[model samples]
Target: MSAFVHPDEIRSRFSAALSAMYRAEVPQYGELLALVSEVNSRVLKADPTGAERLAAAGELARLSEERHGAIRVGTADELATIARAFAVMGMAPVSYYNLAPAGVPVHSTAFRPVEPAALARNPFRVFCSLLRLELIEDEALRAEAAAALARRDIFTPCARTLIETAETAGGLDEDQADRFVSELLETFRWHAQATVSAQTYERLVAAHRLIADVVSFKGPHINHLTPRTLDIDAAQAAMPERGITPKETIEGPPARACPILLRQTSFKALEEAIAFPSGDAVVAGVHTARFGEIEQRGCALTPTGRALYDTALATRDFAALPDDWTALRRNGLAWFRYRATPQGLAARAETADLEDLIALGHVVAEPITYEDFLPVSAAGIFQSNLGAEARGTAYAVDPAKADFEQALGRLVLDEMALYQAEQDASVAATLKALGLTTATA
Candidate 1:
């Protein structure tokens, strides 16, 4: 019998295969390839071992090609439909992120399944969206859009069948998978036909073709197959050096190395020639679909760490930002106790807040990990890159809480009860397998 490939390996293969398919559909993905290579080289030089923790250097480079991609949808039905498509790519909806919380000024949710093993192999991820378009509207135009969406079927019969079969068996065979990809492309191509004008439609088609051909043909989009810079200010300043026009900067906190969770800004999407008007006609306009994005990464803090960070932000003077508040945190000394089990929480509860909390107090503060994304930052980048755009309503939403284990069970399609039983059995089996215990507990 074949050796049992670890779950990590399985996830790696899944990401790789899907990335290749996406590249085939989007062709102009060269920029992504180049950007990732640059980031990898820098990461290697800075800390080889650290970079290898989440992924090996070789895997990071490969996943860079498949990186991640973003998509926008209008409704729950559309969101669920796309979720089915992602399953074929071996992805699951792991976390629900509220875009509005990051100050994007809109109501949006992002789903990401960053499986540790898959990430280790190649951190390919997709950020798909379902916008609350109705809330912020031109009522008449929105009515028209709603009608159009109602009339359309986002997935074809073949695609739907493939999704259903795959959901049952966990995946598709080679032949069925190929057919599903072809049918999905065809469906999207058909949808592109509904743009404002033939020229607009053709432009959209070309853009999708570029993404499909350049990025996914080689595999599903690598974690995100695009240029990612650690320093946006420097990248923006240097854009003219590479003959690329720099877009406006999305302002962020001016800390030297703080992990500004998700501050993204991009150049306007430029135009390219596309055949339209039913004949071999050319359209002259820039496409704002592609843009440059940069991010600053920081320590991943525990929940306590995040809460502490928020409190600091609210209480600290704006001028001090992170610097001035260092003293306050140190003097107050309110840090997290790492082990968060019931016993741990109870033990740590005795030392509440900064004034009474101290390091020797047996409490270790978890680093404040980034929990918010700058949506305006994201949209600014999106808007900067595109020529034409649409507006949508924004609303405040109480964030939803997700228990991680439940997400994992859903992603793997295993019953929670079964998984727990298997885990128990495994523990006992390992003891016996190692001859540390008898068959009977």
Candidate 2:
């Protein structure tokens, strides 16, 4: 057997390739990346301490390279194949998100690197959504959409071959991995020709714009590729200056000194030309979907803290959730990664008083970066792109997470458990390094 390429390297290469493709397909996305780069540089230059802290935590490098894209599939096979494709690249599905409550007829999950090392290497993520055909009110349109979706195979034969090769053989060699990236890239490539006729397309659009998008295309082209920014507020403001029009409101929690969770803003999706089948002739029309997005990430909150955040989000009163990092840690509202300071290692402190140690410069606690999405925020972005018609609950939705997972061929991993485990491991390692016992520290 040939030597296998590491999944992280494969993922990094794939991310770079995907970014290049998106830039060429959507020129504005390239502009968005440059704008994010500018804002991040400006923020880092103004805050040297923050820059140094980011560098120490191994975040500075990844911040610029990090990019997440979104894609929606029409069938269970497409979703399951996408899951397998990502698995070969060391990514796993995490946190099922029900968007029906937000009026979008889809449940979703984020496919991302699960481990800390792989994440630090390249935290590439894809917000994969599966269209809920049952939510389509028009029975005839729903049946047509399902039949059209069933007829299409999103993955290429080569991609399928490589996925199976990777599974049975344990991993792919360098040549296979390179080929895998290219073959997988084909699955996300944009096609302007619609599979359905103009009349069918009109019906699907009338039913819901998203259904048309998922069913009319040759493949589930990535809708948006988002880059991380140190300052999303600045990025949002700078969009217009860069000849981009951003959404009216940013998604997720509002701006804060110590940013919590994720705050995202995006330019409105572009309305591009599409060609639909019209008997012997092709009919030309317009379709809107792809866009560029930027995000600012902060600490992961504990369940208790998340509840407070939910309340604040519901009531539009953010003050109820304290903005101070220390207060958040003291109140057990957030997860933090602990490290023993040089001074603490020299002293070999026996005390497990984390607060006292922090005050004495013996220990440092850094917030664990949130690695999941907020369901409401995800829906807001999707809804904004699809327009008001997307918010119609005229079609009954059960929000069957189990059905979605059954289609996925596996259960989605719980993001909260992953974050908790990371924090627990960090604390144990930090305490051991400092020669102290963990007594509720």
Candidate 3:
């Protein structure tokens, strides 16, 4: 019997391989990585305490290795198959996002590790979107796009075999895991040769650039792979200096002393030469889609906290409302992980009063990092890179979670519920470690 390879190990290997492949495919992404590293290093040096805090939280070790990529699939079969492939890496579809409301004709779900320990080990995620062909106003174009998608199979035969093998055996051994990574990497690899003709590609582009992107490609090539940054503001400021033109405005909330949710910024998508089928000759055309993005993650908010955040965000001035960690916790605005202090662990007192413990410095509370994406932020990234056509009124379809889930073949795990569970589990474990029971204390 071979040793069972842990899913986290597999995921780490796959993420590293994917990053290397993407770096080669998009050289700008490699430059972006270097820029982010410089900024992160500077931030750590300037704020030694911040570095220590991240180290204590187990976030520092994974900071340089963290990456989240996005891809757009054209059909339900492609979506379902990719979901299975991601499952082999211990990732599940987590939250449904309807980009239609934001003028993009697609719905998305972020596939990621659900468990806290798994996430801490390797927080690799993929924001996978499935195109909504029904959203095309032109019936003829929609049908044509559907036909184009129907003719293609994104996954390779070997990839499908490996996914099934892993499923049947409960886990992949070392060799199988390496082969699986290599096979699956092909699905996201960029192909400059379009599967559709130039005329067909133009027709799909007329409907929407994103539609063309999804339907015309050989596979769902990774549109962008974002690396996490400690100070996105600094990175954003330094983008132009590094020869990278960033988008006009950062996607999420403005700079805050205590960052709330996730803030993101990205460079403009590059226009690349692609070959399209045209009779006996292949026609070359320009396509813009892939880009480099950076993110700064903040504390996960509770339901009440998220309500407050939504209310504040509704004003369209996310940065205006300044709230610190203390205020956020007092107002029930964020989820936090609790840990017993050395004093508390030594005393082992039975106390039910959390406030007292916190006030006495017997229990330390730290914000749980938000491990997900924001719908509005996601839409902003898509719209910014998709050119002016994606911003037009024609693509504004209603939000449809049910249809998205139907295509996914499974319901997405509620993001808030996951956060709440993490918060509760941490609190419970902290209390138990301190020799206190919730029933008595």
Per lDDT, the best of the predicted structures is: 2
Highest TM-score model number = 2
What is each predicted model's overall lDDT from 0 to 1?
0.42, 0.91, 0.88
User: What's the lDDT for residue 244 in model 3?
Assistant: 93
**Which pairs clash in model 2?**
none
Better of 2 and 3 by TM-score: 2
Return the TM-score for each candidate structure.
0.58, 0.98, 0.97
> Candidate 3 regions off by >4 Å?
317-322, 394-396, 439-441
Model 3, position 7, has a per-residue lDDT of: 89
RMSD of each: 10.1, 1.2, 1.6
Candidate 2 local lDDT, 1-441, one digit each (tens): 799999999999999999999999999999999998888999999999999999878889799899999999988889999999999999999999988877877889999999989999999999999999888878988899988987889898999999999999999999999999999999898999999998899898887888889999899999999999998888998899999999998999988988899999899999999998888999899999899999889999999999999999989999889999899999999999888889989996857888888888988989999988998898888888988667664445566889999999999999989999988888888788887766476
Sorting all predicted structures by TM-score, with the top scorer first, yields: 2, 3, 1
Q: Give candidate 1 misplaced runs (Cα > 4 Å).
A: 1-29, 46-66, 94-106, 181-192, 196-238, 250-260, 263-265, 272-287, 292-296, 307-376, 386-441
Model 3: colliding residue pairs: 305-333, 352-441
Candidate 2: worst-modelled 10 consecutive residues by lDDT: 389-398
Candidate 1, residue 293: how far the Cα is off, in Å? 3.4
Q: Residue-wise lDDT of candidate 1 within 1-441, one digit each (tens)?
A: 223333333335544554454445444334433544565567557876655632422334443433445655544565666677665665566444445443232233344334433444544455554444433334654454455455556667888897787677666665666666666554333111222334333432333322221111111112222344554565555555545555656444444444434444444443433322344553333222434344543333334443555555556534433432244234332221121223333453443332233333422233222222334445544434433322232345554323222322343232223223433454344333333332221
